[model samples]
Target: MFNEVRRRRAVQRVRPGDGRALKRFRWWQLPFRALFYLRLTRDDGRRTVCAVDVRHWRNNSSGNVKACLYVDGRQHARSGLPAAFPVPGGVVEVRMSAFGLKRCHYVTADGAEYQLVPDGDSAEGRRAHFDRRHPALSRGVGFLSSIVLVVAVFLLVVQLAEQLTRADGVSPYVGAFSSPVDLSAWGNSVVGLITLTASTERALRLRHSWLLDGAAG
Candidate 1:
């Protein structure tokens, strides 16, 4: 079975207005183009706020596209451009207004447009939505994993060098004893060569395994 996975935050909108009216608007008219919409209304009964909207799409790579905002049918001031939209990504904070009477509109990248209405107690909804959707990671697991792998390889090389040193063969003293220092030097050289070859092989094997795993994944 094919599963449909929604991209988080592909598009977002915010509408602040009167509390009671915003609730009615959400139930009746908020656009379904949003994966979800959040509304916020202030406690003082005077301010309303909407949170960003998350959109679902396939290709979001288009760099920051200029968007024109309209307030109650009149062109509003253009704000700073938003972050680049990514493929399969969502948008946020599409619109905002105060009190139940004000409305806002946004014209997005592909010429798709959205309308927002402000209602009471909507600002809280907006804050909640932002908090829930904000991307946060617990830790840098990939970086830590790479660091551990490097350390392991270094230790393995050291262990292999020790084994190679012990594997070196020395000639036995038969008729006359050779200089002990010379015998020791010869043994050390043999061990060094063995260690070099072993280390090279080990490194190649590690790299090969990494590539194989990556391909499989």
Candidate 2:
């Protein structure tokens, strides 16, 4: 129910594009830019390509980002992050996270969902290519990332609980608790780096969980 309301609001935020041509993805823009495409055939049997473009490094101080919708290389419509751009058979939903894009799916009227293809030169594209070319290796890497995030989250929870229990008035009500594992500053930094890499790996695949990625972000 809440999801539908949020979708409706995002739809309302959509604005017509300025009709500028979509530029090719440049290599230097690899870190900041993201582009994804969806191809669909209309009722008239004509096929059209839709693209979603985002520049991660170009957001406001509030971290409010925007997503642009391009049709056959022409700008069509655009909206803020968490946008839903109306298309022929469905809406193209685009969402972002601190690490990168977490969702960019074409949702059909009948409720089916399809993810858009990332631009070939982009980081996400490279990650996806690796998955197709080396499925076993990719799975192993993905599994490793998941495990890293799980351990990170567990440590975070335990530490947070310990902090809460040691707080001024809190320990009186809730008995003091100590974390099973304590890390030095250097160890914490290494854990942080590992978790960041894991989250980025998941983001490349558009895999995000509010509990995992959200807390990490």
Candidate 3:
């Protein structure tokens, strides 16, 4: 996310001109709990839209609210709006200033980021491609599963080690009591080993040619 306070300062209008500009300036100065909309245009003919709909107050609240529209390494146009722009669907189209080169860059608003690419002949196709490549739900689930697995393995190992140490001082008999305890210990040890092994396998798989080859197939 780009810095919101800096964005507002960068885009703040010295004197209001367009309706969009006025709305954006008013929106940027709003209190934190209020909802706002921001539409940023670039120097080149590229537009990226975003909205700020948050309810948290902070010192320099404007810094918490960011809106950026970039072209190449430079920021062409940007805005910082307070949280109260009532645009339908909370979407605003960024417009570019006249006479500039179209280049690749990114835009960020209210923690939401967007890339501004050349509007090709197949605009719909390009958008679909981007959507397919960035499936938020799938990525989130995978991240969460990795975290859970790591935590579960750590807890399992701690519990298993504690139980095994206590059991080691007990009888050497191979009867029913001994058998269940041994089996329990074996089961826990196997689980712990498997968890550690799986983690190692995953790490290796990340850079493994075999995984890539299988995927290519």
Candidate 4:
């Protein structure tokens, strides 16, 4: 129910584009931009390619990290984060997270969802290539990232709870609590770095959980 409401709201944010041509992805933009493509062929021998272009690094400054929808290399529509662009078959949903894009899929009328393919030279594209050539290795890396994120979230929550009890008069009401897993100052910094890396890795695969990746974000 909540998800449906959110999706509807995202759809409401969509606006028609200005008919600008879709620019080519440049190598210098690799670290901040994400580009994906979906080629769909109609029964009439016509084809349209939908492209999702997101500029992630601009989110903090503008607070409007939008997804640009391009059809056949021409600007079609665009919207803020969590965009739902209407296409022929259905809607192409693009959602972002603090680390990177967490979702970019073509959702069909019958409720099926397909992830668009990332550009071959993009970060996501390289990750996809890795998954194809080394399935086991990919799975192993994903598993490790999940484990690291879980551990980081656990420690963060425990430490936060313990500190909250330290406020004046708060300890008397809630009783002082000590974190079972305590880390030194440097250790905490290291954990933060690891959590960021783990979240980024998961982002590449569009894998995210509110509890795990949410904390990192």
For residues 130-177, write the lDDT of model 4, one tens digit per residue.
Answer: 999999999999999999998998898899999999988799899999
lDDT of 2 by residue, 1-217 (tens): 7877888898998989999999999999988999999999999999999999998866534467988999999999978888999999989999999899999999998889999999999999999999999999999999998899889999999989998999889999989999999998899999999999999999999999898888887
Q: Which candidate leads in TM-score?
A: 2
Residue 188 in model 1: lDDT: 53
Q: Report the backbone clash tally of model 3.
A: 10
Which runs in model 1 stand beyond 4 Å of their true positions?
1-139, 170-217
- Which stretches in model 3 have alpha-carbon errors above 4 Å? 1-132, 168-217
Per-residue CA lDDT of candidate 1, range 90-204, in tens?
A: 2223321111111233334354534343233244334234434652421232233344445444544555445455543522222332222332556555644444433332221
- Which of candidates 3 and 4 reaches a greater TM-score? 4
Top-down lDDT ranking? 2, 4, 3, 1
What C-alpha lDDT, on a 0 to 100 scale, does residue 155 get in candidate 3?
A: 52
The RMSD (Cα, Å) of candidate 2 is: 1.5
Residue 72, candidate 3: Cα error in Å is 36
RMSD of each: 22.0, 1.5, 17.5, 2.2
As for candidate 3, its clashing pairs are 27-81, 27-82, 28-80, 28-81, 28-82, 34-83, 35-83, 35-84, 36-83, 36-84
Question: What TM-score does each of the candidates earn?
Answer: 0.19, 0.95, 0.20, 0.91
Higher-TM-score candidate of 2 and 3 = 2
The window of 10 residues in a row where model 4 has the poorest summed lDDT is 55-64
